[model samples]
Target chain A: MLEFILARGNYWVIVALMMTGLYISFSAQNLIKRLVGLSVFQTSVFLFYITLGKVAGGTAPILIGEDLAGHHGAGHEEDAAHGTAAAGHEAPVETPAAPHVETEPVVEVDPETGEPIADPTAIDPAAELAPDAVDPGHSDIPPLQGEDASLMGEPLEDGVTETSDYVLSGHDGAADALHQAAESSLHSVYSNPLPHVLILTAIVVGVATLAVGLALIVRIREAYGTIEADEVRNIDIDVALEEEEAEDAAAEGAA
Target chain B: MNPDHHVILRVVAKTLIPLITLYAFYVQFHGDYSPGGGFQAGVIFAVGIILYALIFGVSSALRLIPPSFTRGLAAAGVLLYAGVGIWALFGGGNYLEYGALLDEPEGGHHGQHIGIILIELGVLFGVAGSMLTIFYAFAGRVAEISDEDW
Candidate 1:
């Protein structure tokens, strides 16, 4: 319920800004005052974008070294355990002295041995040719696998595939996660474009309005030697009365 | 305006504007990890300037930031924002796809941060200057008319 209220709060703020802008544009005689109102309205939208990007319990997606290491360790452990268990036998313990086997292709020669260091984990040979890949000239030594797991005494589960938790959540958790993911993705995609387009449109409209308002101010200055809104309105009223009298006299003369 | 009035208002404006602008920078820089961001901070900073203009007379504010400079700043901000999109395009990605800014697509977060900061700066200038400009335009007209009557 709290989340719902927070989510809708932005919409309410936008509505309020809209109403304020409308009121100021229609009722405020001062041209600059109207621009202020328009800006207030535009700002409310910026607020909306900032609010939408917020993720619950998610840190800024910035990956720190610790975070990267944690993820790498978890993934490596999971893969090694699963692979060994699927083989139906205890995997041979890897020793530090054993030279690592290369599983991937090498594109460069080692400076020391003048031999190409194979990339043990290169999934693609074409990727090996990429300039940014780790220099193939280094010793193609693969890290000892299962050594860490052996130290921990945790038998790595071989191919212990758990059923999708989505099915176990009895539909609610799965649905919620999916909904949240979709919303976040949508927000990410639209957050950039929406504000840019809206602000641009507001600016053009603002400029046009400002131009017209300035022109009116100029005209008011010429007619009454004053550009003040109050003075212009008073002068306009007097002129209307004179025109009305002139029109009445012309009609009487026609009669 | 009285000297005292000028002093008081200037003190207030200086105090508030810097604090608000600092907060804006904080939000813009930390946006990747927080609830605050460029757009929100920009508006707040603009409001702070508007408040300054309101407290001090329009003429005083104009002296601090001329109308022509404000207009130029506003335009420059928009140009900077569009330039980021253009940069992304040149970097071999779709428009605004900051990932393409560098050779490693995964390192695109850095590019995104740069793009966001540039866009936020644009928003800050445009909002603050235009708001101040509007205040000046109305206040000038009103002052001129009132003086004529006197």
Candidate 2:
């Protein structure tokens, strides 16, 4: 029980919100307050679905590029090729720098020797040092580059990338995940797109329902002179009783 | 209603309204690459207009966008959405196949891009129109309810 509670705390909070919204919508006297409650309930449901779709370290559903590796392959190859070409010379590469090229850019081509210089500022001290101690250049290199590169490529989260298939084919495990994520750092993602697509339609439908409900409430207020449910019910009951009495009188008079 | 003046609010609103609309368009167009698309953008767009209505008075807002136009827009938006699907059908593909939007089904992602944009545009119109219409309906009733009724 403790393990379950600890693992799924967000679910508990969502339930609480859902219950509060349901209670308010069902029990509130004022029509507008009820609508507000309904809105709250709708919002909570949205949150629930969003939360469900979230992975431990996932990006949004948007596909930055279809062939994630190839997208950055061209850039990396160009940089490497430029570095090799300029090995004998001392001139900066003329490629339009990646949009995400940071201020203290990492793995930058050195201006003096025109060699790739990994910036110390961009590297995490812990990740860099820890890996070097166990295996100097093999295992630690990729993960460290992954971590730094992921952070460097966050600007593409806004938009303006090539379109491709949204669903990424599953890879093996942590290393593959890290590699894929690091390679296409711009489109780093772990979240499912299915939920986002489903919710897109639901949101519009939800708004339509809210609009119709509001319209009904307005009409009700105009007819009964009150939006309170109890008041409206009482008026309806009185009208029913008056009709019954009039019908009975008419029957007696005809007899 | 009492005539009031708040220079700060008016100035701030003036600045924010254009920014909000701009952001909404950004979200709409950039949605394929980001987390937002038509629904979210439309709501944000409607919110911008709604803010204008609240600040400048419903009468002025309604004058800016008549209720009749909103009704027409709502229907037109649905038609636009359906039209895309019908167009696809005529193109010899399943309804809303999207790949059919392009002349060459084997071409590339351009057809899908076109299809998504059309649907999103439809959604933008539908959502924006209905939201504004609903706001108008609610605000229109204010005159009928006297101050004492509250």
Candidate 3:
């Protein structure tokens, strides 16, 4: 149970932040303080959304030319230019040691020209890759977390799953390991960008709400001469009472 | 807001403002290739303006971008978006179907690119203007808060 909680610690943080923000928002009497609390709550929601989009062994979903191998994000063109950089390398280990790739091409023939295409199967790197060996990084990951399981159908090796930093780690495994690592990096999962894009709009809306709420608070303070909710209510009550007394006097005069 | 109030801040802002604006534009344009897009870029641009207002009072900032202009910017942005959608309709496609804008068989991708750029541009203008307008509305007010309030 502890391991499960630890694995998804980000959720805990989101919950904590949400509760704290809610507490402050509900309990605070001052209008500005309430706004601050609301902002905090909004921030927690943003964190929650962004967290949901994250994948354990993912990169940004930018397409590198015709590779469709790994997503290279905008402005990070260098990432696609330098292949296998997604391997999370400590040094400049290019192509996960390119010469060691032991590729068995799946052959196909073109229908129209009757020409042979050289190994189009190489384009789809993830079709044959599977967890034949224990993936050390994901061995402890809870099976309940369908996030990782759905991606590679197993815990991946360092080149794909282990490195958070955009890649290259030289594992001096045999040629088979090298081949697996190279192919895996290209097919590595990407964090879902849909949530990220949606959250951007959410953030803007949050700010707009904050701005409008704060502006209303300022107007309230100007009119009521206090920022405290109770004080404003008390002032309103006093004015209502005075009006009632005046009405009573007028009725008495008419009588 | 006085010129002598914070010399250091003024100098730093003078140096940083241009870069911030440039970065906002970069984020807006390169949003397709990266994490950022219209909404993110719009917020960044607004932050730059808000930063300026923070250092040099609301009135000073308002001089640079009048409230009317911001309002116009917001309206124009919305109109631009609607205009593009209408244009697509004229091209005999569904509402906002960018591919219909061009007559070419292979024009779908190019049309999509253009449509997305225009939409993003609209979003940028609308968000930036609305944010600035809200900021101005709040900051233009003269609130008297005593030190005891703290």
Candidate 4:
């Protein structure tokens, strides 16, 4: 229970925000407060969309050149060959002054086993459960891939240092993942750009709708001399009562 | 004391508005590769103008961009979006079939590259103009920029 709950912390935060926004919109009597609630709800949706697009160790949807090693000369050549035109962005942040050594992505294939050379413990978890990723019986769950080809720990509460280890080994993992993809694509990802685009469009549309709602509120305030919903209701009731009384008086006079 | 003029606000707004506009354009153009795009850029642009209005008063802002112009801006944006689709049609494909927009048989997604930017432009105009138009309706009081004596 602890493993499941703590590992998936993001869902808890999203739920908290969603409930708060829902409560505010439903309970608020002030017109502005209700709008605020609506905005909060909209924000939750944005968060949800963004969360849906996030991959554990993925870059943005923008395709980097084929060389995950980011070997400056190598990536440049790859960019040219691929015709993707992404030039300056291929290297990691640490490599502004790094030497221009031309190197291919070096995944050491074992002389006998044909398995990739990597830390045994790092590969242990996924190696043990590798069949789960491919098995028909376990197909109901979305395939929880290792961050690379390894480090597929269940992310229980017991480990904090694993994250750092993963970071230190991330680039190696990327290259290895790409290399291994020729046989199997156990883990490699890019965040979905479709949702990114949708959110970009949605944010503007959200604001425009908010503005329309506020404009309506402004007009309401101008016409009714108050922005409170209950106050407006009172004014409406008073007008209806007066009209009814006037109609009754006119009927009596005709009789 | 000249309560009629907000010196600090005016100065601050004067300095910030230009930078905000510049950043908005940067975001607009860099949309494909970066985190920002047309919607965000449009909001930033609108925010710059809105900030100006809040500080210098709505009248000055209206003077800068008349309500008629803003209305036209909104309509023009919608038209631009449709216009791109029509242009694609002229290129001998269905609506918004961006691959047809360019004749480069060997060029990879050249049409998509241009089409996406143009659509982003349309979104920018549509969002910003509608935002300002709504603002004008509220702040200007019955769609009038300057209020006269009853």
Candidate 5:
């Protein structure tokens, strides 16, 4: 989308404005007009920076966490602990446990009689329990907590649950999280010293240039009782001719 | 002052000059995330003020920003920039290396921010002062030489 905008109209406008400003700055004899042109030219660069920093669906690089509103957080010690735990081992506790008993019953119920009727296809209980029986009284296994119940709310077919569903369902919350992440990344990248340093240098150079330019203008105005460049130039030519004539007369007098 | 010129152009120029300068500071402070910094924004802001001087005459603008003060400001800005780097150097780090100043070998990123801000402020001062100086020089010349310098 940003590419489209730049390509379609913004790019041309920026270029045109920059060129126009440069042309005015160079061609115009008036100092004020030249400054105006320089400003226009500078504005184009500003627009370029703004355009380059643009990111689609990206928010301002501000950390909005409760602890640091609009500040980026550095790496924490807890992150290292988590990393160690993840790298150390594949703990059995991490896997979802199989259900102890089957939820579906084999018996068919008659709708009219409201009675359970034994089906001929029902397997013997002993045979069914031989291979898949799970002990319910295992002391080592802790009872399931709220975490287990929450996981259970998901589809039962797959022993493992899809975390994506939970995140996807929370559209606004997920977007906020993503936005925060993007913002922090932007902060990290933009917070570097290089650009700031460059800008500082540019400003100093710009100031010095402006100062020198102003000094020149002052000298010009003093030389001719007018700030106008054309008037100054004419005065300079007249002065030069007067000096030349004086030198010629002096040489002739010496001869 | 010509009331008509003051009414139309001066008012707008006055409002824009400060507004742009304030915006430049905002950009410098928030540069860690935004598309602005001390230098670029500072130049724009200084240019804005120069525009004000151009449109409303230098005397009016000089009332707000005196020439003598701006020269000091320019030097002060350079001092600020060098101060940060020197502080870092004194802290046992290489020049311009901000991490040493904080005594946190690992907090280099944080130091960079501090250093950047210092340098940016320096740039802002230099640009604003110099730009104003330019305006002053030209305007002063116009004042002294032109029949209608006022």
Candidate 6:
């Protein structure tokens, strides 16, 4: 439980921020104070999303073409070796160093043209070319491999580009430790793009709401002569009481 | 507001306003590549104008940008945004389908860029105009109430 809490400390901070903002928004008597609390609440929510999007050691999602090219070259050799091994080249199948990678799904190929179909399930070639490896500085580890090219209906070198490429692919025994590190970096650690995009729209909407709210407050102040919530409530209550009393008096006269 | 105001403040404000305006435009255009976009740029532009109004009376600011014009510009901005979507629909694509605007297949990417720029410009105009209008409405009433009344 301690480890779980420690691992998710960011969530705790988010909860604290949310609770503080909520408390202030509900309990604050001043209308402006309440608005401030609302803004604080919005800010906390933004922080929550941004925190959720953070990868442990991941860089910004933007890809550099030069880096991808470099990774692409390194990946090709590993892919070829894996292809040959899978084709019964008598190469050692198991690497002593690297953890065994479950064979990934092969790309479907059209038999007529001997070309790979654009499989949506395949990680984008661009994304595959991306140094998705967590430690970008350490280039010594080989690219992770996709299925052997021979396994697909077409030749690996001609049709398969991204799927066959992997870090430390053939040198399973030699690069096993690095492969595990890369594997850890590949899966659980990446940021989700959805929240980032969603929050962009949310922020604009939030600002629009804030602007309208402030405008309404200004109009309210002009009509009531005070912005205090207590004062405004009292004024409204007095007007309601006057209406009720007038209605009662009118009813009595009618009777 | 006075012609004989503190020389330093007047000079500093004069220097800063142009820079702020330039930065707002930069943010507007550079938004595609960077962190800022139409909403941010609009707010910055409004802030620059509001700062001017604070240093030099509201009347001076109003003279620069009349409230009537601001109101119209706000509506125009919204119309522009909607117009782009309509234009795309008329071009035989779904609403706001930027690719449909590309006459040539090779221009598909460029067409999307054009659509984004147009909408962002609309957002800029709407946000800046409305913000200024709101400021004008609020400031115009200051004469009726004295500071001590608060």
lDDT of 1 by residue, A1-255 (tens): 333333244466777887887788667766557666766665666655454433222222233333223211112223333332111111121111111212211112221111212333532322333242322212122221343212122322222101101011112344554565456435332222234545656665756566566656555655677545677788889999999999999999999
Q: For model 3, how does the per-residue alpha-carbon lDDT over A33-136 read when each residue is reduced to its tens digit?
A: 88888888988888877765554444432222332332211212232343331221111111121112222111111111111112223321222221323222
Instruction: Kindly report the docking quality category of candidate 6.
Output: incorrect
DockQ of 6: 0.14
Task: For residues B1-150, write the lDDT of model 1, one tens digit per residue.
Answer: 766667766887778888977887787667545665655665666676667667776677678778888788767777877787888788876576555555343323566556666667676666656655665566555433444453
Stretches of candidate 6 exceeding 4 Å from the true structure: A57-193, B143-147
Among the numbered candidates, top DockQ falls to 6
Writing each residue's lDDT as its tens digit, candidate 6 over A1-255 gives 333233344667778888888888889887777888888788789877765554433333332344434322222223433442211111111111111222221211111111112223333433443355333311111222254322222222322232222211222232443454366457434454456767877787777778778777777776787888889999999999999999999999999
Off by over 4 Å in 1: A1-255, B5-14, B142-144, B147-150
Worst 10 residues of 4 chain A by lDDT: A107-116
* Candidate with the greatest TM-score versus the true structure: 6
Error of 1 at B34 (Å): 2.3
Error of 4 at A72 (Å): 33
Q: What is the TM-score of each candidate against the true structure?
A: 0.43, 0.63, 0.64, 0.63, 0.45, 0.66
Give the per-residue lDDT of model 3 (tens digit) for B19-127: 8888899999987556677777877898899888888777878898898988888888788778888887887755776665664363135665677788888888888
lDDT of 3: 0.59
DockQ of 3: 0.13
Sort by TM-score, top down from the best: 6, 3, 4, 2, 5, 1
Model 5 TM-score is 0.45
**Lowest summed lDDT window (length 10), candidate 2 chain A:** A156-165
If you assessed candidate 1 against the hidden native complex, which CAPRI class would it receive? incorrect
Report interface Cα RMSD per prediction.
15.4, 15.6, 13.0, 9.2, 11.7, 14.9
If both were scored by TM-score, which would come out higher, candidate 2 or candidate 6? 6
DockQ of every candidate: 0.08, 0.08, 0.13, 0.13, 0.13, 0.14
Over B60-98, each residue of candidate 4 has an lDDT whose tens digit, in order, gives 899999888888887888888888899988877568756
In the range A109-205, model 4's lDDT, one tens digit per residue, is 1111111122233333323322332221111112223543222343322122222112212123444433433222134333444566688668867
